[model samples]
Target: MFTAESSFTGDFKLVPLKWAERARKSYPLESTSTAKAVNYGMYTPESMWNKCTYVISELLNECLVGSWVFAISPTAADLSTIASWISDILVDSASLVLVVLEWFQVLSAWEKTFGMPVLTRQDSEVTYSIVPAKCYWTVFAHAGASWQAKHVELVTQLREKVAIRKAAAANKQKRPEDDEDDDEVDARLHKARKRPQKNENKMQTILPTEKAKAAQQVEQPEEEEAVDICSDDSDDGYIYSDEDYSE
Candidate 1:
């Protein structure tokens, strides 16, 4: 049995209740604040507590018997009887609490035996007990720890595969409008890419014509200058220039 005590510094401690103290008085009888904190089976009568212990013992017996029977029989255990016993235990609030606390103790014992640290708080750091490295390592690798690690890895991989399957299924279930939207996007991209090539081809076709027109304009101006030079030479060659001016 555990008793809670608060120190002057406001720290809480769980002290084991002495047999005298545990048996001195029956579970809290009054509706006081302290009494309210205690659960139904926590400080109850010895008979009630013993009943809970007996139920646990019976469960262990069932497991032992079932294991032996399973070696010879195809049906390993009487699942109905086991389930009935569990239901009977859980029906009583005190019995349920006892089972939970007992399970916690079992876990603590296993952790101690396996050199694993018992977690006491939500934010507690998990570290191994001080033991030989090789010994603990061998125990952990060979025991259920390795199997649990592999199980977690497999579960993670299964979740990833499930997510991938869901995404693929969603993609496959696309609406016709979605497909149309995708096609429209592809067409727009194709057009955008082709526009620059079309402009380049147009420039290629237009450039030679523009160059020919420019060359024609330049040659026309040069031909006009040559004709003016020829006419001036012919007038110089004519000897009636002075007589023409007098007339």
Candidate 2:
């Protein structure tokens, strides 16, 4: 978990506005005019917004140890926007800390109220701190025009990946309607096996015992059948007489 205070050093070395003003006065008028023209009077503000942005960005890039970064341009709207962006990043970082704190609080409350341990050991506690120097370096790297767009694209890719993962997890929890279709197919197969067939050949073949019993009960007289058989038989046990019977 990360906290705003822990993610950024509370002790930032900010140069006073008076010092910047004094420094600006020391520069030649021609240089001052050129800088002013190029930066839209970025150096004049009493809040030292441009100076803070430059310092913070440089520090973040140089240190490379923390998440704090001055992302806004020095020529941006005003001190308010810079302050707001910094505050927003701090709040975002702090929210992660708050979440972990809330989770622990909930666990503690559960343990006290229900008399059951929610966590096994206090040794598993996590600690957070800002790596001020590294954080400054990271911010400085993005100060370049090309790097800013790259950073935006990287952040977008990360967000998209997270969304895809969340969707996959949600899909894993859902039961699709195909299961019901499978059940219906099984029921139909069971019903088909139980139902009687309309075709005579199919029905007769299926019920062999009934067909055999019916055939046995239909008896023919042996004496009448024997006389017909004897009249039909010829010398060589042929049913029809031929012109030649040598054998």
Clashes of each: 0, 16
In order, candidate lDDTs are 0.33, 0.34
**lDDT (tens digit, per residue) of candidate 1 on 1-247:** 1222311111112223566675322232222222222132223232221112112131123211112111111111331111101111111212121221101111243365768644342234321111110112222333432433443344356556767988998989979999999999999999999999999999999999999999989888543434342245554575445567688
Judged by lDDT, which candidate is best?
Answer: 2
Poorly placed runs, candidate 2 (over 4 Å): 1-144, 175-221, 225-247
What is the overall TM-score of model 2 with all chains considered together?
A: 0.27
For candidate 1, give the lDDT of residue 190: 99
Give Cα distance to truth, residue 101, candidate 1, Å: 34
Clashing pairs in 1: none
Candidate 2 residue lDDT tens string, 130-204: 111112223433354454244435445655676798899988773668778878999999888766554666767
The estimated TM-scores of all candidates read 0.26, 0.27
* True lDDT of residue 60, candidate 1: 27
